[model samples]
Target: MFDRRSFLGSAAVAGGLLPLPEALSAQALAPVPLPPPDLYGKNEDAYWAALRRQFLIPADVVNLNVGTVGSSPRPVLKAIFDGFEQTEQMTQAGSEDYPIWGYGSWDDYRKPFADFMGAQVDQMAILRNCTEANSYIANGFDMKAGDEVLISDEEHGSGEMPWMLRQRRYGMVVKKFAMPKPPKSPADILNRINDAITPRTKIFFVSHISTATGVVLPIKDIAALARSKGIVSAVDGAHAPGMMKVDLNDLGCDLYTGSMHKWLFATKGTGFLYLRDEAIMDRVWNTIATGGYDDPTRKADRYMQIGSSCIPTLMGLNAAVAFANAIGIDRIEKRNRMLADHIHAEMMKRGAESWTSPDPALRCAIATVNVPPVQRMELQDWLWKNHKVRIRGGNPSRLRLATPYFLSKSDIDRFLGLFDAFRKMKGVA
Candidate 1:
């Protein structure tokens, strides 16, 4: 219902050029409702079809690249647009009150997401993005020049680069452990991590889900191992929150960082840094300082003092959380795994070797495969330009397919069919 005319009209009004039509404005801001509860009991496929209507992605275009980013559903978009309208009016009861997000403890916005992530409001700091949170961990955590931070070899650039930058500038040691190409069990990963640790190991920083192969690491075991050794455990959970259920307390990690924009389908700039307690918080200096940056009484809120930021984005984040809650994360996770397993099985049948974990518990929505004798860039361009199908992968072979709950099995089938057609065309079938 978001038309070009209404968008332009709103922009014009913001510029003091013209008044927006009341009906158009109302239509633009209206919330998209979830499918009725009874629909799920009647026809599960139809229920998912109804839920799929909530997304703005065109019916013809299929997006399998949610690992890189996600399309926010209509309800979250509505909340952001509505928030901007309400906040831009600039009429406040308190003379000191402002619309910016980074100044004070905005418990109203923080508490809902905190509860969703299984953490207290005092332990969560609303940050701009996962990269910023990772940078904060690397640049702010107390470490001696020769101290080591052990990480997996398959970390995302954002997760790895910050530590690399720190190492280059401060002379800290960055250590790496190779992950099994397709780990058959949790012990395969755990043993590598254990062997990599030494006396100088100050931190065990790894991803909850591997960004490269889409493998879910054994985080609880990793956290326990770190705790036993008195090494700080930090997780780059950028892809975990919406893909599966996350409980920070249960995971028992000292620190965690993630982005809501990727899988949670929240606003683009929303992310968080979670500190377990005051002891961990004290070890990290504020990366971006303001008035309350050094205040211990503020708890995790003190880290959020990074000057002015967008409040409408946080509003969208809350709406995203509500949207997931309405559908129930358990149901969403099940659907995600089913779709991923389906795709993985189909790709295996096509002689594509699995890069994702063989263990179901070690893999979730993302299903990675290595298809040799076919150039990935060539196939990637062909699928997108010709078939309107989008996928992401590395050169030579690897394909990382992300299955959001919104995608139907038929969508995966279409991609599979296209893959067959492409292979046949190239004489690689």
Candidate 2:
């Protein structure tokens, strides 16, 4: 299958560079034990059962917080290592192999990436990370000193940083839209955004899923409203790609960016950015200064990769998407929701309430359970120090559980059991 000579020839021509991980060894991994077939069934519950077979998770920890980061399967990880090893081997031999890009052309990655996102291939740009992707949109927009850019408090640092930098440096107006704690309805949330809008509002920036408190926005309606107001919509979907089913067309946003490493289970340092069309994206400067500035078609690639980067990661990143496609994104999504529902139900049974997301339809794989500010801080220390369950600690009386598709119901049950035990031990019960 791997015509080593042909691929090596191509790699030499592209750029004499080899990947990391030193190539496959003679010894291979032993057969992995899978979950019981019956545990995963017809619905989301069943899908979870099937999905758990794919992951190679450590037995000691209950990793319900895939919301923050996810692990790719053995195949993807192996590919990543192969890329590194190949590159390193070539380098050691006083030769170089292909560059960071796998396809002869950038469109090879774009088409499949766009297909996954439900966007036209031409509109998508593969980026290094979510920070780079969001910065491209944030700093690239055509704006004046007083031009209004509306953003939510719930946004990640990636969305908030660039605009904040722009406001101070360039004198742009950054408007903060206030969302209700427990939003009455999607309309109520929209009203908050609408109320902030004025004639000068040129940009509407929000996250499809918030990384901090885990609030999932109704981006479709919000995007539609932004369209009516002639505003450019940019979403920080760092938590959406692998955690949920994200169709860019359905969301109706002008621009969307997400991290592959965080949720897609791709290797670290890969991300995606989509511009509705080329015409709108021209506002951003091409990060590459050496070449391709004159060629409009090549601008996207040049912008995504500025200089020498980890090509091995890209190869593995590509394989990660292929794996996701093979498994079915919808099936992955349904199970993530089912797992979140499991966590939510169990937390409620233990007498803990939430300041987290409520709209089940909008929520993806993440859910936050607050155990009263003081209670959470102490319990959080206890869980990690005394107990082995790994989770994200919080400041706002919450613990965020970003369940990956691979985590099992029994795992969730175990986490619940821990919480209930913790509650009784802490005297909450």
Candidate 3:
């Protein structure tokens, strides 16, 4: 075990990623100092390295809660602001000159994005965040008071609210079931859903990855089962799109929603929703309409594409998707997992139990550590304010960590070092 005394005095913990580059020596690593909060424009890797460079985390402020949000990459940020400024300039140049809705604008966003996620261009729709994506289906569902919907405890408010909101107004019953602890097998989780599902169950809602638990659910199997039962399966894919492998068409779920901002590395407020050609096309009616809202059948498109968005961010999403594909999804997933495993291993070495999933197959780049006796906020403040290390945290009084594709094993080692230091300070045996 990575015992307490050894944890504090260990030379292994010396720098603790302070000059994270030291630990990154073995890899093609580049540690950037994070930009001062005031500045949000820079794309050069070296500039980015400096920006991500100094994280003063000391358990007092490790932001491990990435399920809620992720920091934008330097390039993505630069692209967004640059695009924003360019638009401002274009608008100043005059309306006719600044043709906003050319048939080409949204189409440029199509093929590349579809290629990245392994879906056909027409099947993917550029929507905002997971909430909006899922809501499209949730609000459009053809339901009656007697119908039932199945969801897991891991469902976020976005996934849960629409159903509940409908329940109050529509009288549909929202049945939430708990997933198996550690979710050892797909069958283990499916059985729970199977039990709660009755003839009344018309739809199944699942999170591709539970934001609350860093646990990756087996959507394929569950989705197949839902299909077998003649129920529609809609997935809350907020964490999966950017964090791991997701081919919407192949996954076979009825509908899917995702946030491009998280693992997708797109600018914030950009995301997409996908519908199986058979699942949503023409079956759901548009609840809202605006100008040119002639056909209620084609209204789903208008429902989502309403109001203008960050033109550059949406364009950059296409770029981010292309970048992810060029890098290879499997490669990024492997790198992210390796860093997470490193952190888990070191925490285990120190004899600290993980509050998150331990099974690698059931987990992802995100993980949470249970910190005994110490207040989470207190620990977070100390680590970030004193040690200069950065980690994410949230409720349940634990540390949640997400290793993006950009992180490496040495980065993991650095995090472990700080964890070791903290354990020692707490006098953990």
Best by lDDT: 1
lDDT of each candidate versus the true structure: 0.92, 0.73, 0.67
lDDT of 2 at 359: 69
TM-score of each: 0.95, 0.85, 0.79
Identify the candidate with maximal TM-score: 1
Clashes of 3: 43
Writing each residue's lDDT as its tens digit, candidate 1 over 1-429 gives 345456767788899887667566455455666789998889889889999988878899999999999988888988888787777778757898777977989999999999999999999999999999999999999998999999999999999999999999999999999999999999999999999999999999999999999999999999999999999999999998888999998999999999999889999999899999999999999888999999999999999999999889999999999999998889889999999999999999999999997788889999999999888999999999999999998888899899998899999999999999988999995
TM match of model 1 to true structure: 0.95
lDDT string, candidate 3, 190-262, tens digits = 8998898899999899988877667788889988999999998888888887688878878888778888887
Which residue segments of model 2 deviate by more than 4 Å? 1-53, 89-97, 102-105, 287-290
Global lDDT for candidate 2? 0.73
